[model samples]
Target: MEKFEALIGEMEEYGRSNHVPIINEKGMPVLLEMVRQKKPHRVLEIGTAIGYSALLIANNSADDVEIDTLELSQERADIARAYIDRSAYKDRIRIHIGDAGENILKLSGKYDFVFIDAAKGQYPDYFRKVYPLLTENAMVLADNVLFRGYVRGAAECPRRFKTIVKRLREYISLVSENNEFETVIREDGDGLAVSQRLPKENNR
Candidate 1:
C-alpha cells in the first residue's frame, strides 16, 4: 500500500514537472467514488495522458476490470506505458495509440464506464462515437467540460477560445438535454461532467 502511494506521488510530481495535463486533484475524489460505486468490469478511457487517471481507475476498480485507453501521441503513450509497467495493473490497462476518434471505433467490447479527458474541443465527437459502445446504465465521465468557465459564462469568450467554447456547449447539451442520459456538471477542478446512459428501453 505504501509503495503504491509512493508511486502515485512520483507520478504527480512527474506530471507537474513535465506539463502533462492530469486529472485535477480536487476532482479525483468524485472520479474514484464513481469507480468504486460502479465497480465496473470493463472501462474505457478516451485519454491516457501519462496514464495518471488510468492508474487511478485501475487501482480502484474491480479485480478483473479491463481498461482500454486511447492516446494520440506515441511519445506520451510510451511515457504512460513506462509508468503503467511499474504498477500492479500494468497488464490490465492496454494503451491504444492514435486518434481517439478512430480508436474508439476499433474497440471490440462494451464498457460500463467511460472517461473522456482528451481534446477539449472534441468532447461531442468523442461522446457520439462512444455512445454505441456503452452498456445501458454506463457512466460516462468527462473532465474539463467547463473549460475554465467559458462554457457557461455570461461574458464574451476570447476569440481564440470561441470555437472550443461552442463545441463544449454542444457537448453539454448533448448529455444534459438528451433524454437518454442523466448529466451533471461538477464544478470541482476545471470541471467534470458525469453522464449516465439510461437503459436501452428508456432511450427509444
Candidate 2:
C-alpha cells in the first residue's frame, strides 16, 4: 500500500510538470466511489493520461477487474505504461494507443463502467460509439462536461470553445433525454456527468 501511494504521488507530480490533465482532487472521490459501489468486472476508460484514473479504478474495483484504457498519443500512452508497470495492476490495465474515437469502435467486450476524459469536442461521438458496448445498468462517467463553466453556466462561450461547448451540451442532452439512461451532473471539478443505463425491461 505504501509503495502504491508513493507511485501515485509521482504520477500526480509528473502530470503537473508535463501539463497533462488528470482528474482533479474534487472529482476523484466521486469516481472512486462509483467504482467501489458498482464493482464492475469490466471497465473501459476513454482517456488514459498517465494512467492516474485507470490505476485508481483498478485499485478500488474487485480483484479480478479488467480495465481497457484508450489513449490517442503514443507518447502519453508510453508514459502511462511506465506508471502502470510500477504498480501491482500492470497486468490489469491495458493501454491502447490510437485515435480514441476509432479505438472505441474496435473494442468488443461488454463494459460495466466507462470513464470518458478525452477530446471534449468529440464527446458526443465517443458516447454514441460506446453506448452499444455497455452492459445493462452500466455507468458512464464523463469528465469535463462543463468546460470552464460554459456548458450550462451563465458564462459566455468564447469563439474558440464554441464547438467544444456545443458538443458537450449535445453529449449531455443525449444522455439526459435518453429513455434508457438516468443522468445526473455533478458540479465538481470542471464537471462530471454520471449516467447509468436502465435495464432493457425498464427502458421506455
Candidate 3:
C-alpha cells in the first residue's frame, strides 16, 4: 500500500494547489479497477468535490465514455472546472453546478455507472434519483458509508452530523435488504458500498 499512499500524496498535493478535495488514491484505485472491469459507456457522479473521483473513473475507462459530475458547492465546482479546463480530460468530464438530485432528474440519458460521495444523509434520496437513470447491469458506488466508524455509534455523535450518520445506516440497511440489487460493503478509506442492479426478473 506504500505505492498507493504515494499516489494519494501526489493527488493531495495537486488538490492543495488547485483548491479541491482530494480522493483517497489507495481506496480509489480499487474502484478504478472495478471501472476497468466494467468498461462502462457512461458515468454519473453525484459529488465533484474538485472532480478527483470522476477523473479517476474517466482515466480508468476508454476514451469513448463520458463522465458527468454534480457539485453543490460553487467554489468547489469552479475549482473542478479550472482543473478540468487545464487537463486533457476537459472534454470527457462535464461538471454541473446544482443539487445532484435535481441534476439527476433532468438528465436525459441512461448511465452504466453512478458514483455517490455527497452528503451522507442524502444517500437514499440520491439513490432514488439515480435509480431511474441506470441501465440494466448498471452499478452504483457510495463512499464513506462507515462515517469514520461512527455509523455504529451515531447515537453518541453530536446532533448535527449524527442525524446524517443515522440516515446513512438506514440507507445501507435498506439497500442490504432489497433484492433488486446486490450490495457489498468494503473496508477502505472510510468505507465503500458497491451495488449492482440485478436483472429485470430479479426485481420485485
Counting clashing residue pairs in each candidate, in order, gives 0, 0, 0
Better of 1 and 2 by TM-score: 2
Tens digit per residue, CA lDDT, model 1, 1-204: 237788889999999998999998888998998899998889999999899899999989889999999999999999999989998988999999999999988888799999999998999999999989989779999998888888886777899999899899899999998888889898888888999778778773
Model 3 local distance difference test score? 0.80
Cα lDDT of model 3 by residue, 87-193, tens digit:
56678898889988788888878998888888888999999878888899998888888887788643467777778888889879877877888999887887888
After superposition, candidate 3 runs with Cα above 4 Å error: 1-11, 16-20, 153-155, 202-204
CA lDDT of each prediction against the hidden true structure? 0.91, 0.93, 0.80
Could you say which candidate leads in TM-score? 2
TM-score of 1: 0.95
For model 3, the run of ten residues with the poorest summed lDDT = 1-10
By lDDT, the best candidate is: 2
Off by over 4 Å in 2: none
- State the local distance difference test value for candidate 2: 0.93
Better of 1 and 3 by TM-score: 1
